[model samples]
Every structure is written in C-alpha cells, then in structure tokens.
Target: MTMEIPIIEIKGVGPETAKDLEGLQIATVEDLFEHFPYRYENYEVRDLSTVKHDEKITVEGKVHSEPSLTFFNRKKSRLTVRVFIDRYLITAVIFNRSYLKKQLQIGETVTITGKWDQHRASIAVAEIKKGKEKRSRVIEPVYAVKGNVGVKQLRKIMSAAFAQYATQIVDALPEQLRTQYKLMDRVDALKAIHFPLDFRQVKQARRRLVYEELLLFQLRMQAFKMLQRREGKGSPIPVKKEDAASFISKLPFPLTQAQQRVMNEILSDLKKPYHMNRLLQGDVGSGKTVVAAIALFAVAKAGFQGALMVPTEILAEQHEVSLKALLEHEQVKVALLTSTVKGKRRRELTESLKNGEIDVLVGTHALIQDDVAFHNLGLVITDEQHRFGVVQRRTLSAKGNNPDVLHMTATPIPRTLAISAFGDMDVSTIDELPAGRKEIRTFWAKHDMLERVLTFVDAELQKGRQAYVICPLIEESDQLDVQNAIDVHGQLQHYFQKYNVGLMHGRLSPQEKEEVMVGFKENHTQILVSTTVVEVGVNVPNATVMVIYDAERFGLSQLHQLRGRVGRGSDQSYCVLIADAKSEVSQERMRIMTETGDGFKLSEHDLKLRGPGDFFGKKQSGLPEFKMADVVHDYRTLSVARDDAAALMHAEAFWKDDSYTALRHYLEQNGVFNKERLD
Candidate 1:
C-alpha cells in the first residue's frame, strides 16, 4: 500500500508543512491525492468590449504612458500607468509593486488582469504579465488553504505528490465500462483534476472523477442494504392494523391518500422479519406526523415501546402533547424527555420506560443517553431527522435489539439527493397535502412597506386569526443589519396595543419557552414575534398570518418551513416576507418564495443554492465530501453512475470476480466504508 506513504515523503513538504497539511485532514499520499481543488481560476484574456464593471478580466494593451510609483502609508506603494488595448484606453494601477514601473515604460506593450471600473475607465490590476509572453496565463487549481499553508504551496505539494505516487492510483472502473461511459483512466483523471492543462481537460477529468466517486458511494450503500437484508435479525413486530384502524376511527379526520400510502409502506416493513431502514419525506405541512403516529400506535399495540427523538425541546414537548392526544384514549402512555425533564421526574420517566409502562417516549437527543432504556423496543422514529447525525441515530437505535428505524424529514429532498445521500435506506414520499388544507398565499414586500403589511396583519387579527412576525436575530448585533425578535416584538406590541404580542428566542429558559409557546397556542397572544427557533415543529392552526421580517436573510427551505407554521387549519393562510433584499441572490430567493409554495421545488432550488452539505448538515445526512461531484449540477452523471453501480453490485461475481478485482481492491484499500457506517 504505497498510497499509505506519509505525505512528508513528498519533496518540499517538510515536517512543519506536513503538520499544516494534516490540519486539512491530509496525512498520507492518498489523502493528498483526494484533496482535490474546490475551484479553478482561468487567467485567459477576455474581450474588453463585453466586459462589465467590477468584473475580473485579462487584456493585453500597449503602455500609453510611463508608469509612476507613489509611496503611501510608509510601506504601501501604487504603480499607475495608462494602456490602450484595441479601441479602448484605460488606466491600470498595481498596488505595493513599485518595482513594476521599470517594466511599464511608455511605447511598450503590457498585459494585465483585474476588476474593470467602467465609470473611472480603469482597472485595479491584480496581476501584471511580465516579459514578452504572448499567450494567456495558465489556468490554476485553487485548493482550500487554512492557516500556514498558502494556495501556491499546496499546489506545489500536490504536483509533487502526483509526480511521485500517481501510478499507485489504480483504475477501478473496468475497461468495458470506461469505454462505454467514455471516461478517462483513474490515474489520468486524478492527475488532470489536480493540475489540469486547460478548462476542457478540467471538465473531462471532472466528469470521470465525479462518476468514480458517486459509483463507489452507491456500491457501498447497495452492499450495505444487501447485507442487512441477508441478516434479518430485526424484531418481527406484528402489523396490528386493526388497532391502528381503531385509533384512526377515533381521530377527528381520516388519513389522506399520501399518508395512508406511506403508513402502509412503513407498517408493511414492520411486519417483515428484517429491520426497516426507510426515509419518510414530506412537504412542510403534508401530514407526516400523523403517519408517524399511526406507526407508533401499531408498534405500541404489538407490546413494544417506540421512541421519537427530535432536534429541540419545544418540538419534543409538542410531539408529546399531540401524540398523547392521539393515542392516550387507546391506553398508550406517552412521555416527554429533554434536558428540562430533570431530577425526580426524569428518574420516574426512565424507570417507567424500562418497565414497559410508557408505550411511547418522545424527546430530544436525551433519548440517546446511556441511562435511557426501552423494554421490548420495537420502533425508533426521528422527527425532522436531518438535524441529527448518523452517530446519534445509531446510538439511539442501539438501545434496542435491532429495532425498525424510521427517519422523517419535513424538508422535501430532491430525488437526486435521496438516491445518493440516503441511498442505503428505502424511500417513501408523501407529496400530497390533506384534502381540506388550503394553499398558503405568499407575499414579498420591501421593508419600507411595513406599515401596509402591519395593516394587513391587523385585519387578520381583527377577524379572530392570530399572526406571527419572525425576525432573523434574537437581539441586535453590531455586525449584521437584520431585524431582531425583541425589537420587533416591542414594535408590534406598540402598534397592536389592544392585543398581546409574545416574544421567544433561544436565550430564554426552557420553562419560559414553554410558557410563551403555550400562550401563543392557547390564543392568549394575538401576535408572536420570534426568531428561527419556531421553524421545526410548532403547530398553531388558528394563527393564519405569518410575517417574516428580513426574510431575505433566510433560505428558501427555511422560509417554506416558517410558512408551514400557518396553513394548518381550513382558514386561508397568508405569509408576508418583508425584507430589504439588495443582492440579486436574495431577491431571487424572495421571488421564489412568493412564486410557489411547493417545498420540493423550493428544496431543489435550495440544494442548488446552498449545496447538499449545507442543506442537510453533512454529518447528519452521512453524505461523503465529494471533491469533483456536485449532487445538484451533476445529477445526470449521478443518475447514470447510480444505475451502473447498482448493476455492478448485483453482478454474479462482483466481490470475487477478476473483472472487479481492481474495483473492490480500490474501495477496500481506500477504506470507503467502516463498521459503524455499515451497521
């Protein structure tokens, strides 16, 4: 395993530099190769005629004036000169480079790249081409450099690594598949990705490398799924549909088609002798909770306890209240556990849970504590499951003897991500809303129009409907220019003095948060001004109006989640997004929020905007940190590679076949999967 050779073996990377590289998670030769550039900068000359103001461009021109150097602030100096390129004349200034004046003589041709200042007809020169080199600058790979390590230094180290150890990089894709897919050899792609000769080579190499990464990932996932299926060690909980039916009969309304479909899918999995690994994806207000409730009730009736873990204490309490109301009559005892549940109550609750007296336990990460135990645990359900990492989920599930695990997310995930990130699990989508639920009318307004927006909220409040005014910050900050909950609450209270306006933020104690939530839920507060803490699972049907101040500060998915707080009941709901959106990206986010209420569409846009790592905290989704593959932009490649991987995984001799020898060896030696991950 030469790939295991220490990075310090590379020339120019001494012990100090090696320690710095290790800060970036690069300790071995293989690690250095895998540390691909995040982006590439092309210094090729551009057409000056089409260049915009403040845009980076490179152009060659004659030196129309002698360069004059001026010293400033003792150490800083500016070298200014005028150059004419084609038909346009512009001034170029290079800061702190007084020595460049000798090279920038009049009547001499010069080339420079910098941001174009159209109004001033000048360029803030980033780099000045020296000597008579006529061709455009080389396209350079840009690595993510932290402390001590510079980009140029990293690039040098990478080139050295490639020079010495690239031959050790084996081609995992068989020749037949590579030929069919028109992919480059693994060694060539890795070399090109690190030191691409041109933009075209970068693209081609990226295509090949992205495919390899995604294929390996999918193979790992499919293999895990196959192994789990073969094991079949899960508790064979009886599918007590009759008990679920009786509970549903007592409910105020029947399950929607999507809910029934997903519920049946989950229950059917429970009936199997093998453990169920499934993802339940639904829109913000698509009734996913009801489906979860039904599953839990069935599990409880089967003489086994269920555990529901959420991200926040407020959400845990809310789930406990709702689940209790839904299952208490059926003699199913539901309890809440969080950091707030302490001392005597905590001990009593845990003891009841161990004794099998509590049929269902709902809580935050507290459910994963070593002290927490479940008697005959049959099912584990996590609400808004994306907020918890894989380790947390596994630890909670480990408390039981191979219990069925159901992960749910209110944020609708795109199909591409579902196939890659959660590829190991079966997927169940709830795309339909309840029959009587109304579409939430969304609006975008400038911050200056707050008076008019308040008037609308006032009208809604007058009609006996409550409202929510959300801000980006809990308190004022010296850095960010955004609305804060405390100030907004004060302003709203002053304006709507006739009604109570409640305020909530993270700094508040758990009891205070509970009191505020209870006040708002009971309609004791007409308007609730809060921060993003209310995004997860605060359900208030009577509140029909949602006004988000500084809405542009939020992502599309987040805005959609906040809007889901309303629109729960039959009454028409309205969401007003008030912001001083300056950037086009922010404006576009606001426009999309007003355009449609589809969480899937918004989530797709969100994925494209924020990427999968940020969209679902990377560790929580267990998505690998891919260097070349982008789940959003490269979805087509992802799909093709996914299918190819599935076929190869299902092949008769994938593990032992000679054709797949290189592939299996590459993956195993590369350490793609671990015991904890597979389990």
Candidate 2:
C-alpha cells in the first residue's frame, strides 16, 4: 500500500493552472518536488521603533486609525491606501485594488507582510490578513510562482509532494562518498530545500544538492568520454617532426611556448587512431587561429580535405583570408563559400569541393546546407565554438565521415564551466600571448570624458590612423533609453564632418555592410560608427582606437572581444569604455578589463561574479542550467566530483554494482548518453 500525497492524489488541477505549471516545466508531483526556490525571504520580526524605513521586516502593531483611500487616476482606476501602525502612519498602496476599501474597517487591527519601499517610506504589503493570531517565521521560502500559485499555496503542494516522494528518492551517491563530502541524504536535502527551518539549514541543504547534481553530471560525462575513447573510429594522419618545425619556422614571429605545447598535443591526438574531439580555448589574440591553421595544413598534407566553419559571413571571409595567406607557401587550394555566393560561382565551388579539387573550404552555416557536399573531409574546425549550437556542430560533423573536430574559442571559460559545458571533449589551452604584442590601454570614463576621448581620436585620425566607435543598440526603442548607433553616427558626422564617417549594423543589408567595412579597411572611413556587428571581424590594421558606448551593457567576454578589435595591429592601441551606470558588478566587470589582459582570469572572475547561467545565455548552449551551484564558490566541490567520477568509472566494481543505477537513469533521462539525439 502507498501513502497518498495531496498534490499527487488530488485530481482537480484545472487545465489553465496546469498550463501555468507547464510553463515552469513542472507537470507532476516529481517536478514540483524538484522546482527549487531561487531565493529565500528571511522575515525577521522587529519593533516599530527598531524598523528601518527601507529595510524589509515583519512587525506586529495595533491599528490605531481607520484606513484612508485616495484616488490617483480615474482613467486607470488606480488607488492608494494609508494605514497607521500604532501612532506612526505607513501607506499600503495597491494598483487596481479599489475594492479592498470594503475590507478595512475603522480602527481594525491587521497583520501585513511585504517589502518596505524607501521612496514611499512605507511597507508595501504583498499579503495582509485580519486578526492578531497570525504567526510569522524568521525564514521564509520564496519560490517561483505560477498562475494562482502563491507562496503559501506552493509550499502546501511541495509539502504534499515531498511526503510521498521522500521514500522514493534514491541516493545517487554512495553512503561513504556522501559521508566523506559532509553531504546530507538526497531525500533530506530535497525536503530541507523546499522547507528549511533556518538559513543555515537552507545553505547546508543547497550545498548538498548542488554537489549531487554536479557529481552526477560529472559521472555521466566521464562515462561518455570513456565510451567515446573505446568505440570512436579515427584514422591517424602522420606528420614528421621536421615538417611541423618547418611550418612553424616559416611564420613571421616565433611561436609562444603555450602555442607550441598545444600544437604538440593536437599532433599527438591526430596520430592516435581515435578521432580528435578537442576544444582549443585561449584569450583574444592568443594565436589560436595560427595554431588551427597549422593543424589544418598538417591534415591537408596527409591527403585529407579540411573544412573551417564560422558563425558569420564576415568571420568566414576573415578566416579564408588569414588561412590562405598562412598556407599560401604550401601547395593547397583554399576556397570560400557564403550565402552571398550566387548561382554559377556557388555551383563551381560545390563541384570543386565534391571532387576533392579544393584542399580546404571555409564558410558559414552555408557549409552545412543540404546542397553542400564534401569529398574526403577528414578534419573540421569551428571558430567561436560556443556561438554554434550542439545540433549545428553535429550537422556539420555529419557532412564528413565523423571527421576529427577541433573547435576553437577566443572566449576563455572558467575550469568548472569548461568541465560542465564541454565535458564530452578534451580541452587544450593557449595560456600565453604571442611576443611583440602590447597590452591595450583600457579605461573607464564618465560622460564628461567624451570630449577628451573624441579629441584623442581626432589626434589619431590626423596621423592617418583609423578608429572604431561601437554603440550598444542599432535603433531607438521607446522601451530602452540607450543611445542608438544611427543617432551616434549623426552626432559624429556633425562633430567630425572633415573626416569620413561610415556606419554598419545588423539592420543594414549585406552589400551595404560590405561596402562600409571595405571603406573602413581601406582608410576611406577614418571613423566607423557601428553596432556589435563588427565585433567578430572587420579587422583594420591602421585602427588604434576603440570607444565602446554603454560598456556596462556588455558581458566581460564580449567587452574583451570588442577591445580585441583595436590591439591587433603592431602600434599601441587604446580602448575607452564610456558607462553611465554605477552598479558595483558593472564597475567590477569594467575593472577586469583595465586590471588584467588575461582572458582566462577575466572569465574566472566573470563566472564568480555573474554565475554560470548568466555568463552563457540560458538558451544558447545545451549545458545544464545550474540553479544554485556557483562555479566560483563550488570549485572545490567540482574538482572532487570530477575526480570521484573518474575514479568510479575506472573501478571494475562500477560495471557490476547497482549503486550507480539511479545515476545512469538520470543521465539517460537528461539525454547526455545519446550524442546522436542532441540535435
């Protein structure tokens, strides 16, 4: 016999309410049990005298006066209420709640709870009840609400679900492991997460749950990696040490020790029978592209065609130019394919690719289109790997016979995140920058600094050098008060009319964008005022100044990428960040740019400050969205989990034991085991 839980046994959840729950991805008792609270509300009771005007608190006071109502707008039917707590008066305003006037009688005592607004200098009551018998706790669980699902209602449903599922909750981790990690039982942790008696209990329970989630995820990743190593089919493409040395010797500058180390690792992986599914991560201007080009050349020399896929047409074009120049001395044919390539030219390129006439092909998503086919494609390279989804990468990989994949990214991801997000692939890092590159001078300035910045740009332009002016938005929107690129372009044109000004944005056509980019590159336009469309490409060697407007609106990595546009040339460059907002996080993010040029250090700081989900847009990557596990605070746990997963997978006991059965089930349910189904 099974004990019936109220939420599970009760059959009267209406379709409308069910749809609201579905929006949160909660449809059953199990889903409700796992729907953790985003934050906790600690309502500490305080006396009226001790109550701060703006601080949130719960107080019990006698109502000394009758509630008074005032009408603000008859058109919108807005009303405000004034109530006195003892002798001190405080206002409780509600929108479109004029009907509440009937409930508050003269000199009636009531208990109210909500956030205290400093602007109004009153407590904004979110919930109110009559009589003095109401009991308020010190700690309150604030859950994400659905339609008709208030905190109290959500608590009741969760309580019922926990009662039923507590016994059914299987421990994913072994008893010894849990004890060693100082973690609570899975069932107890879930219960405490939903209904914690105190803040300490909540914190402890959250830590355990976060550890478990990460541990299971790490286990699955380790298992998948092992399976891939065992079963993956790959052919070794051999290259002599002298051949690699000759290629590196021909480069304009000497390779950094870090770059040489990464190349050697890739060379070893290529020599192995198993295909290489490796991620090459480095800071902007860390010489990732050069390393990738070397690997492509090696593969090409091995008599296998290689393809480089980028996210945008401009990046595709840029890669083609860079790779062609790098491999020009070598006997290899490289071709570019983009959406812009039309009719006869497209047909010719496709025919050449299919016939193995082209040694290397570089293009955007056009490479994966149904009409596009490859001949003897043995290696694949994707720049800015995070921009492409898992399905998109798989689609490109499927173009060839499961070719060896080498994904590259300029955005330096934190170690914890790298393991969680790209756990299925081996990682290589280029930790050092190339020689002779000067660190770009970065500064954060207020609006008052604009004139000085413009004067500086004018001085640079006078010397025949170019500059880039980046705006956050393309067009004006009534919703946001941000400065648009078009408005900035007009202002710049008026201010710097003597110099040519060019504009580019996502709204502009490909032809118009190409024209402006070409002008900027050729110095026809000394100042290119544009949006982030130029963030990925549009490299101008003569440009030495980059002024980013509203720098606070950009992520740390993105801001780093924008700054990378200028410092590419040999001459000294300056990046001026103009921000009006004075948020602490924003200030810290900007400070990272000024303080250090290391992309990995900045990324670690970003993860610590912004958390994982916010660092990577929730919908952008298929990596699991963490609710509580912070990569910064949980780094130790992440390391332990990674080690534990690896050790367990290597143990012969894992295959025979039923202890990991629940973990395996969880992985399968999350689709981590099935690589083919990721798309």
Candidate 3:
C-alpha cells in the first residue's frame, strides 16, 4: 500500500514543498488523504447585482477596461480589475500578485470567486480563472495550510498524488463491514473529500472518514481493556448489604435515591471476579463523596486498604477530614498524604500505608509515588478524573494488584461521548441532587448591573448568608482584559467593609487555600472572592449567592460548576453572571447557563457548542484526536462505529483472517493493539 509512502516521493513535491507540508504533519501519503477540509467554497455562478456583501460567490464577467496596478508600500502591491457582468459593474481587488498582470488582460472573459467586501465596495479575489466552466460545480476544499502554501498549489499536488497512488490506498475496514454500514469506498471517500462535486458528496466523504476514525479509536480502547484483563487476576471483595446500609445510615444526611442506586451499582462491581473500571458521574452537590466513602468503608471492612487520589492538595485535605469523620466510628483509619506532608511525616504515612495501619489513604498525585505502597490495596478512587491523565491514574492503580477502580467525575459528559471515549468502562450516574438541595436561580446581567448586584449581595450578607465573587483570572494580565480575582477582591472588600472578604486562587499555597476555605466555611468570611479553584470539592452550604465576574469568558460546564457551589444548603440560592459579551456564542453560553441547572444537559450543550478539543483542553479524555470525527455532530455515526468495533473485537475474522490484514496492520502501526501480557 502507498499509505506509508512519503510525500517527497510524490511527483511535484520537491524538498522545499515537502518540508512545508511537514509543518502541517503531512509527511506521508496517508497524512495527505487524512488532511480533511476545514471548510468548503461553492463556486456557484452569480450575477454582480444579486451578490451581497460578505457572500462568497463566483462571477463570470468580461473585463471592461485595462487592468490597473497600484503600489501600496515597499514590497506590497494591489491590482484592480473592473468587470462588467449582466449590465452591472463590479470591482475585483488582488493583493501582492503583480505576476498575474499577464493572465488578467482587458476584455478577457475571466471567472472570479471571492468574498464581497461591503466597506471597500470590492471583492477580495480568492481565485481567478480564464474562460467559463465546462464541468459541474466544484466544491473547493479550504485546508489549514501553513508556510505560505497556496490552496491551488496544494490541490494540484493532491490531485496528482491521487491520480498516481490512489489505487494502492487499501480500505482499513473490511468489505462486508463497509457494506453493512453503507459507507463510501476508502478511495472514493478520499477523492470526494479532496475535490467534491457538491456539498452532498462532502457529507458522504466525511461520514466514511468519521466512521473509520472512530472505529479505529474504539478498537484501540477495547485492546486496552483486554490488556488490563491479562495483567492480573482481580480479588473479588465481598460487600454485605447491611454494611452498605449502615454506612449510608451513619452519614450526617440521608443519601439521595439516585445516590443509593449508584452505590448499588458500584458495590456490585466491587464484588465481581474481574477488576472494575467504572466511571461514577454526578453533578455538583450530588453526594458523590458520601457514596465513595461508603465504597471505601466496604473495602476496608473486607480487610483491604483503599486509596483516593484527587487533583488538589486542598481537596484531598477536605476529603480526609470528611471521610475520617464519617468512618471513625467504624474503626476505619484514614490518612492524608500530599506534597506538603514531607520528611518524617511523609515516611510515616508511607510506612503506615504499607503496613495496613491506614485503612484508607487520601492524597493528590503524590499517592502514585513509588514509596506510597498499599499492603492490600482493594479499590482505587480518583476524584476529578479529567484533571489526572490516564497514565497518572494507571500509576496509582498499579500500586495495587488488579484493584477495582472507580473514577469519579463531576464534569458531566454526554452519554455518546462517554461511550465513545470510555467505552471500556461501565458508567454510573448520580442524576438527582440530594434531598433538601435548593435549586439555584441563575441570572445573566451586564457590567452596568454591578451596583445593584453588589447591593443584593450585601442584603444577602446581612441575612447571614455568604456569597462568592468569582473571576476568570487571579491577577491582572496585560494581554487579557478580563476581571482578576485580586482586583475584584479589593473592590468587593471596599464595597462591603463591614463583611469579611477572603481571596483564593490556584496560585495560593495549600495552607493558604485551606485557611481561606476554613474562613468561608465557618462564615467568618461573608464573601469569598476566588478563581475557578473553588469549582470543586469546596462545600459551603451558607453561600447562597455566587457572583461571577466576566462570566462570558467561561464555558457552559464551568459556569454550571460555579453555580453548583451555591444551593448546596436548604437556602434558596442565586447565581449572577456578569459579563459584557457581545458575541453570539458568548451570549448563547450565558443564556444556556441561565436556562438550566442540569449539568448533564449543560455538558451536552457545551460539547455541541465547543468542539471536544476545547472542551477537554490540553488533557486527554481517553479520546484520540480524530482528523474528521466530531463526537457531538457525528454522534449517530460514532455509535455505529462503536458497535462495529465491538463486533470486530469479538470476531475471529479480525484476528485470524488474511482479508483483515490492513485493519490489523493499521492498528499495529498506530500502537493501538496491545500484545497480551505473557503471564
């Protein structure tokens, strides 16, 4: 197959052009095929009078006069061509292309395709071709090019490459599978993707590509699941129904029905013969911690140690206090280990953990360190699962022998995405908030309403309720013109001099964060000014008001999380979003936040609005960056791909048949398929 053929081997790609293509990670023939269009331009013929400003169109016209050239600055030139089309006059502007003077002759019947600029009353020429169209309309692909590579130049190179080596492009999916899915042939898909006849063709091509991308990804995850099973045998820890009920009964508050259901699912997994890789998803104030504490208690009662890893030191500290208090009567010992626990204290914790003196250990990433060994590690629970990378989670689990792993994520992922991303794991959701939890009333307001908002917050403070003033940044940034927590803290302090104001951000030390949180939790601080650090694990029930400054800069999921901090208590809470965002997208995000408090629904909205890349940020959500597959937009296709992957994983043809060579080879080349551990 020509899949591995280097771009340099292609006919028009010289060393210079190859190096330029390399910038966009297109070094091989397969990469060229996978470089899908960022957008498409339809060259539908349009008359000058019918064309609107900012609309991209192709207009065929005769040059009315001799083309003129104007020099703008040194090394900069502009060419102006006036054209007569359908008894209407239109101006075409070309920049820095003095070499085009010869081809753009007077009275020449040329076709121009470009965006009409209303202000300049001219069209910025994207492309100009002499004569009329002899073929059907072409949907030109616009690629994410780099190194000054023109669209025409890249298209020409791709055309030549396809004409020469397309036949060698083997289909990664088997013929029967492709037929079952009714997908376009791999070669035809590549061709249509690069140079489609119409928008329908583009969709067809994308459907095939998206399916292939997602299928390969799912296959990879499935392979990982198989590898995990081969690693070691799991210890089936027994869970008594009475024990679980006792643990829940001992909690300060009764568990929600949803929490009880999720707890049952988790306990059932712990008792399975195979190791559990389950995801526990819940919204804010859903009592996920109480459920986790119950699981930890069950594990401890079964004569095994359990470890809980969180993202932040402060969160770990908070969990330790709560869990120890909840399980102290049960004789379950809980220990806290973080970076701050150093020297003699760290060694003592490690020794205690290794000697089974500590029934449960809670810490940050430090729990994965080599010295933190567990005598009988039965279960591993990671809070804020997205914050920790897959390797970090694996490292902690590796400390135990096939430990039942329960990943807890407050970030609600759409079910389709969760299936596509974490297909290997089972999922349990605490869909309902705890009983007595108040519904947070959300409001979107502009900066002009700040005075009234502050007054309202002051009133709330007088009523003995606390508030949170959240900012996007910690300190003033020269580049970003957004509200900073430090400045906002000072402003709020001055506004409400009688009420105490506390400051918190990611930059604060663990001890400092703990101190600030302690003040806010105890009501010593009437208003807590903070960054997104307070988004997770800080439960202050009396905080009835949440004022987020510059809320437009945040995503829907984040806004939902901030709103979650309030309404934890029985008091009716309010979340005020203050921003001057004028963009349609920003306005939509704010509107969604004000419309619903459901995290799962907000997450689905966020995924659809913001692509998965921006939604997950720089971290890997156990999902590969597909070249074309969109988790939200192509949700149906993703499901089909997942189903296909499951069937393939179970089929003997996928493993032993020679016809499946390409699929196996592709997976092997990408290191997606793992060799079974030789136990």
The digit string of per-residue lDDT tens for model 2 on 173-277 reads: 777788887889877888788777787888889888888877877887887877676666666777565777889899988999999999999988887876789
Residue 207 of model 2 has an lDDT of 86
Clashing residue pairs in candidate 1 are none
Error of 2 at 83 (Å): 20
Residues 16-49, candidate 1, lDDT per residue (tens digit)?
9999999999999988888888887767777788
Candidate 1 local distance difference test against the native: 0.85
Stretches > 4 Å off in candidate 2: 1-6, 10-25, 38-140, 162-165, 195-199, 220-232, 239-242, 312-314, 337-357, 369-374, 387-392, 608-611, 621-623, 646-650, 671-679
RMSD of each: 4.9, 5.9, 4.3
TM-score of each: 0.81, 0.80, 0.86
The lDDT per prediction is 0.85, 0.80, 0.85
Q: Worst ten-residue run, lDDT, model 1?
A: 670-679
Give residue 499's lDDT in candidate 1 (0 to 100).
99
Whole-model lDDT, candidate 2? 0.80
Ranking by TM-score: 3, 1, 2
Superior by TM-score: candidate 1 or candidate 2: 1
